[model samples]
Target: MASYASKQLLSIAIIFFCALGHLTSAQIVTLEVKEGNSTCIKAELVARFSVAYNTTNGTRTVTFPFPGNATVGNRSSCGGTELPPLLAASFGDGHALILRFSINGSQYRVESLALEYNLNDSSIFPNSSSPSLVTVKTDSAGILAQINTTYRCESSWPVSLGGGSGNASGNASVTFSNMRLQAYMLGSDLSRNETVCTADQSVTTVAPKTSPVTPAPVPTVPGNPERGNYNVTNNNGTICLMAYMGLQLNLTYPSSVQNKTVQEVVNLQPNQTKSSGSCEVSNATLQLRDDRTNLTFSFTLNTTSNKYHLSGISITATWPDMKEPFSASNGSLDYLRGTLGRSYLCSAEQTLVVDQTFAINTFHLQVQPFGVNGGQFEAAEECQLDEDNMLIPIIVGAALAGLVLIVLIAYLIGRKRSHAGYQTI
Candidate 1:
């Protein structure tokens, strides 16, 4: 009975020591932030870790609390909290124990922030079994902490076991990790109004072609030149003007030349007029040139509501040594009528000349540097029949003369025949 009691006491002692050893081996893992040398008050702290163990083995688990606050900018302000319940394992390894936390919103600048956590192990073991070695090292290979900020700061630590193991017993170990902190200042304003002006100016010259004119009979007027009489001269000249985008201008001509009255005509070339959409020229000015006229124009951009006012348009005609200036004018600016686009005015003068018979002459004018932006100029002269139909009157007179001659001849012949037939009656 005495031997059995001694043996039972020894067995009790062995069991108590084994349990104590296991308790000592279990470890509490922790992460901490160290303050760095910086005066700015801005920093962020982040921590990540994983816990793994065997499930089938005699492994047990425990729940632990994570740290929240860290020292920043010489003050304890920035902090984080555990998202989920902290878990540990003893014997069997199953799913990974993932720990993730972040610390921010601390306006104060700090040198660095620290992190700390606990990892515990509880597992049953066979008698005289070797102690299991468990390690709590940085999850990422050779990387413990990462600091990403405007300032160049970092964390430092070596990977190793948190605590020593006990023979067939459980233990709790504490692990330490740290990161350095740095801070910076930030700032931001609005914009003003302005105006601008632009212009496009150009000049061009033109020479026109002429066609032969058919002559028509002239009417007799005692005191005036034959109404429809015109003599063709070799002095035919022409000028051609073309404006792709169109243009606006004003022209004037002399009312009379050398005491002879003159006439002016305005006509659009046949099949040459073109328009697109609702675009058309309105309120246009047309006149005969007797004196100088001024021309002004306002150009508008198609894509935007912008206008450009241009003036000082001068036209001069040069023939050998003769140079004559013509007058031009422009319309008032219409801010509201932006779609009017372009307009034009053209005029010419004519005079009657008497040498032996009557001849009509026209004053020649040339537009110097005759074109503007996308604009062209053309001029030509040809002998054309007068508006009056003098050819019809001439034909009627000839027919009447032929008829009168035939009647006279017939009367003479009839008188002769009667005299011959009467004999001495």
Candidate 2:
């Protein structure tokens, strides 16, 4: 009886700890991508939804709880080397969500995302047909980032798909939030590594000193730039590079064009037209310009080994007192090195010093340097910063495992000693 009691206690302890661990982890569901009978990608996702529907007198909104156990249905276009890979999921009661992806050259993007919920199935809309649900595509919540990278950010931002159509028409008024996704996994099992996003970076939000009522002095160091997804596509609708960063350029140009040097800051961002960057099989470019400055970043593709990197940078600037715009070029620097169809990630700030004249800093940066395939980030090369960030969890997990092992060993020895004094009577 004593031995049996000890064994039972050991089992109970293990179960209790496991349950506690599960409760502490994020509420996410697992998804698998099968490629030719092999499970190529495994992911965990957490999605929540808010939807609007018609009523007898007016309209109403319903917010859904954390989506649990949503499965990718048969119509999903996974396991292909195609332009886009899609995941379609249908929850119970005719509620569904679909995610579309685009991969080109060196980047991947969320092409489209839609949420569907049947008004008839929802208890709030009692007198509706079974197929009365509408679908809404989010116009702004598209996540543009690298291919084959782990994306992590705890967001409460509401991403509206649309349907404010205001017409009594059966259009979807849908939104989603608290989205956590790890997709295009390199191995069958999902990895816990995460690439930092620009949204998670510190912003330069120092309000300008204006009113006399303001007491504190304004800060001199600028905060982070607004990070966003920037891409370029070819005339053939093929992608070249997909970059995500809050990009800022620092130039130490001669203040008088004769030799007195000082700092000049330029921001690189997407424009209204041709906002999607440009790409080719051999190389890609991201460009932004102002009235006096033109800046371009060039990435080179390695076809033989199927890899790519940020290889070159060029700028044209016309400062005051200078008659002609000065030109600067730097090539053969490997910044974000990554495999084709994969991404490169750096959580910490990165600086590329082209020369004393100019330097580039990228924050909250995750990029698919080249060779995006199947509209999915399937593999990744982590920057030293991200790798180091990932290591912390690993080290902590190892310590926890060691502690568990020690307790297990102690229990085993106790059980063995108890058994020594008795036989299988």
In order, the Cα lDDT scores of the candidates are 0.24, 0.57
What's the residue-level lDDT of 131 in candidate 2?
32
RMSD per candidate (Å) reads 52.0, 20.6
Distance from true location, Cα of 317 in model 1, Å: 5.6
Residue 162 deviation, candidate 1, in Å?
99
For 196-230, candidate 2 gives per-residue lDDT tens digits of 33233223453322223222222233566668776
Per-residue lDDT tens digits of candidate 1, residues 1-425? 33444455456556655654543332332222232442222322222222223244544333232223322222232232433111122222211222222323321122112222223323222221233444332211111111222221122111111222333222222122232223222210000110000000011121111111201111211111111111111113222122222222211233323232221222222133332111112222111121222222222222332211111122232212222443322222111111112222112222211111111222222121121223333232111111112333564576457545555665565566656766874
Point out the worst 10-residue segment of candidate 2 by lDDT: 209-218
Q: Against the hidden reference, what TM-scores do the models get?
A: 0.15, 0.42
* Most TM-score-accurate candidate: 2
Model 1 ranges off by over 4 Å = 1-400, 403-409, 412-420, 423-425
